[model samples]
Target: MRSVPRSAEFRNGGISFWFRELGCPERRAALLDTVDYDVCIVGGGYTGLWTAYYLQRADPGLRIALLESEFCGFGASGRNGGWLSAEFAGSRERYAQLHSKGAAIALQRALMNSVDEVIDTAGDEGIDADIVKGGMRLVATNPAQRSRLHAEVGYRQEWGFWPEDLHLLEHTDASRLHVDGTIAAAHSPHAARVQPAKLAVGLANVVEGLGVHLFEGSAVTEIRPGDGNARPAAVTEHGVVRADHVIRATEGYPVHPRGQGQEWQPARSSMIVTEPLTDDMWRHIGWEGREVLGDAAHAFVYAQRTADGRIAIGGSDAPFRTGPARDDNGATEPQTIAELWRGLARLFPIAAEVPIVHAWSGAVGVARDRCPSVDLDRDTGLGWAGGYAGSGVTAANLAGRTLRDLVLGHGTELTRLPWVGHQARAWRREPWRRIGPQLVNGLYRTADRRESRRVTRTSRFAGLAARMAGREPHEPGPGGNAPGSPDRPGAIGEASGAAGPE
Candidate 1:
């Protein structure tokens, strides 16, 4: 049997470095008494909190209650890589197929606006999240990666992104941005670096201050829809929360309501953070721009320069659990931690000496179509949004706004976004659900290793793997994963749970 790696010497549960520095929020009282409200939100992450935030803003008199199994930011929202990016979690082609190409473009624009919306709201609401809009810097170290970056740029321009919005840089130019061994790079101003935990906690505080009742440590056990003249209710071990409308906002965590679990495949992503780097170390690694960084590998890696000078990096290196159960405490496998360290060293040779200070992991939801969705059943008064497929930061904010519009019965632009009302097919049950994703993960790992060994412009091995991984080759452009628009099909975490949440 393989021994777990020693790199897991630090904190391994889902408590992120950001949370370690920002400090988690104190647990609030559980729901011991039955209560009634205008709306009841189950989940205290960004989706739930943001929904409460906007709902209160839209109608101050509306009573909103948020329920959490743990303290706010205790799940993926607090442990995610701090990238507020416009990268949609699903294929653009899928969105176009559901709606229209114009609709897809509108969704992209809305996501971009959501990034700014988050930054602006944090400032206006006194939620200091160390927000830095340095944009995203995607680097390619191999020939295939270089070609893929170029293709992505062309697609973006064709999809209405200005040439300036997606600019490609040569190795010489890109090397100035701290990423070494880059053959090509691309920069998009539609992304930002943030302290995720700070943002989640700040939002929780903001919502609570807005008269939204937030009940932590209250694990919701069931959701019962009301019939005529009755209100929907969420049952907990403590009591039942009855409201006119019940919204399911628990992404990554288990959804208590029946039928909801069929739609989401929970996958865990692992992460590690290095001890504070010295000025000399930073000088050697000239990433002063602080743009959130990612590589062009099939097993993609994402990183951010923390406000405290630490390099926190993460990837989907762990196996998905057998059931809906999650690694709630943030602990990750020792091998996952080790691989992340190796990736960091490879990306920045100067960081080989940087000791790791913290390690953690978190789960993210994957819809059957690998896209985020928002919907409300007017008949049952039940609304839900999640399955972000690792891009949940800004997506959650957009989902919150969408839920608000849906609940208020407004046919606004937010409600018409391509993701709204899109019904993804449910994942296969049992061993198939568990085994299928594992096979894809194994194929991806094999392909990444084989491609590096061959050093070829394109890897047939990775292509075959992608096909087996359930992604169609015909996916479109704009986004790298667009169906049939293959400049670089491997640019995304195509494997079900191959990377960190947004």
Candidate 2:
């Protein structure tokens, strides 16, 4: 069914195949003169774009300006695995412990709603990103994984989730979905597949259509919040953007103004997309519905069947750089891409020979407590949202709506969500931040290897690894499920580099 030739080789380097459909958005003119607006947003990824969209809808007269270092969606937004699942970054218990259970549940419901909101809005806006609402399936290949998955399902039911929201499936039932080696699996109907770059480009265009000033290639060098009496301003090398409010929506990228380095840790994720499969290959896989698929591993993998019949798989085993640095260009490490190919082959052996057509990597911001936050300080007229921990495609939309509510001082249900006004602890500097991700990655892979050999009980080493990695013990690594969902718990650049597409 693929129109593209199977002989097509890898498209190496930064640009993903998703971004090529639009033939690369011409970089808009940079801001060269001082400009004044009612609102100034830094980072033109989904967070900024969505925030602009909602804000303009709420009040069209609000003068808003958005600045991006590169083109919009050039960061994690353009390069993610395109999963719009209701996966909150932190544990539901964590959210409840920090705030109230009501608040936690409210946030969970909001996330579930955000997925539909995105699809509905995209339709109304005429932004076709090859969207498919097949939902998500998480397979457990080992007994240990099965145990954890069942526990997750039980926990979700206990939390008052309807039986239909999340439930387990037998191996036979799961195999029908093309996820091989499925001892057990969890299914959730609240997910969808998307073409990440197309959605990003579409949003950028839609927001521009709404009269929002989008400045590409304009990197913000400084963010100067105003005193109680004055307005805040974002300083670019060529211009200054003064506004009543200043927003920092940079996810996965380095912290700007040369400070707040400890505020967020940069984690990288890489992915590889295989050449489009033939009809015979499709019959072999048996995933005609094309539900977004993920597996249960200490170091997990996530995948989706591209509209073009290709398979794009992603994971976060790449080494972490020192000083919390990020790779702006979506380039992949050879080893990372190879590992991803191996993961894809393991899941679908019939396509083991499928050529990988593209590979890329991106970075995402990780908060200290592994939870995202949206906060606005009316005193300083500063608002920001990020730290999605990797499951941010849908979370970003929620964050944008939350940011809009906070900025406008409406304080509806969006603002009442547990993540609103949250200030996670800062990550440790250098040795701890740099060495932590590597240590965690090594431990997870080791745990996965050991668990694969065992027939009963989860590995104690895996639990330790999860704890060290700042994830809940027994959860299926980082890409498990929504924190409070029946499946288990769970990112940001709209699509943090940890999860793929980026």
Candidate 3:
């Protein structure tokens, strides 16, 4: 039997191991007085940072301001699993329903390209976030999972993904990774490993260097739309930022202006990073390629090999908090840490003895439908981009570019993407909001448990849970399962936004 390390054995909550490795960035001064700019972006996470980056690049003369409640990269931006994979954030069928199947395919293709876009931008900006485009591995350890894996690969092919984009690994090729109990695997070239905090910090610097006003510790209390000749404004504790366009880029930690908190539910994901593994441990693991790893299960895990020789993995074992409350200090529960550690051991037993150096938690915004959206209202000069679930790393970049197009009123292809202007219904209120995630996640956990016991087909419990969440059981969506399932194929085993382990 695997040994469970005592909670006291590991350090928890210094934000994350990534932040501790690089050290927290010096906090910028907060917005102390009213300011006016062409664009004011609320939130300093990737969505806001990317939006600022793209808008500044598009028009260097346009004055922009970015407001953050804490230091930049303090949220999920700094705490994500660091898989910059081209995972679609929402259901393709849903997107197709809004536009056309062709548009949905275009969105997938665009996201695939976004993986490279981020890498290229990082290179151009000289931001080294330990990126390795070695690709992603989705492993299936059981018969039920293996069946879904095959269906996922088939779905991708049917959706017109190139062989180089996605393909099933031969048994010999699958053996190369040496992950325990891997019956089958799928490979996608569009994923990359990154140090998420580094990227967030570096991008913040890049935008600041471009003359965008970045006000750290500036909490936006409310975002008020413009009226008559007035411009939209972001009201903060210290001051107000009035701008022609006010972009809400708060992602998982949204502070809705009108108490419409149910628009996006804040979900939490926890992670654990082991101390640097020894060379012998690496040999036993055989993850020389350093591909981002995931498993095909209802409740899944994502992992990456750090440049400093540690394994950082995360998942959504405990996915939500009641109401809109979230843990800002990155504290993770003991059971979550233990569960994540056990998952790591299950995948790579050789590292089971490695001490866990750090464990932390972060939030991701999940829309009711589990899809992401980028919307802009020209008349009110109000705009927003987020709800990436757990695929925000790359999706944020696309959102930033799309936001730029919308703000500039450019009839670009990005403006035509189906997710642009898409708005998911608000989540159910009250006890349901609190109980819904826990209940669904519990069902998923149960389904995963049953699947582990040699179940031959996808568990009905999973489908039932999906249905309860208002997702089609058999349609391809962000978190859907089954062949041509409602969930997006490439992200089947991916961590949800808060639980993003990539």
Q: Which candidate ranks first by TM-score, i.e. highest?
A: 3
Please report how far candidate 2 places residue 244 from its true position, in Å. Answer: 0.6
Clashes of each: 13, 13, 14
Residue-level lDDT tens digits of model 2 in 411-500:
698888888888877766446566765776676666667778964666666556566655553232443221111123321111323445
Q: Alpha-carbon error at 84 in model 3, in Å?
A: 0.2
Give stretches of model 3 more than 4 Å off.
Answer: 1-3, 6-9, 259-261, 319-322, 474-491, 496-499
Ranking by lDDT: 3, 1, 2
Q: Write the per-residue lDDT of candidate 1 for residues 1-502, one digit (tens) a residue.
A: 3222333445656377777787777889899999999999999988999999999999999999999988998888888888888776666778888788898888878888998999999999999998899888887777766666677677767554677777887657676677677777888888888888888898998999999998998999899887778788999998889998999998767664654546777777777888878999898787777888877766667888988898888877544333464565777777777778777876887877777878887778777677778999888888999887677888899999999999999899999888888888876665666665556555555555665666555566556555655565434111122112133443342221213635
Question: In candidate 1, where is summed lDDT lowest over 10 consecutive residues?
Answer: 476-485
Top lDDT prediction, candidate number: 3
True lDDT of residue 354, candidate 1: 73
TM-score of each: 0.93, 0.92, 0.94
For residues 1-502, write the lDDT of model 3, one tens digit per residue: 4555533557788788889899999999999998899999999988899899998999999999999999988898898899898776777767777799899889989989888999999999999999999899999989888888887777766554778888899998987688998989999988888999999999999999999999998989898988768888999888999999999998888878554446777777878898889998888778889899888877778899999899888887454343564665888887788778878988998888888888888888777776788988887889998877777888898999999998888988898988988888887765766677677777777777888886777777777666766666334222221122224333465552344742
**Weakest 10 consecutive residues of candidate 3 by summed lDDT:** 476-485
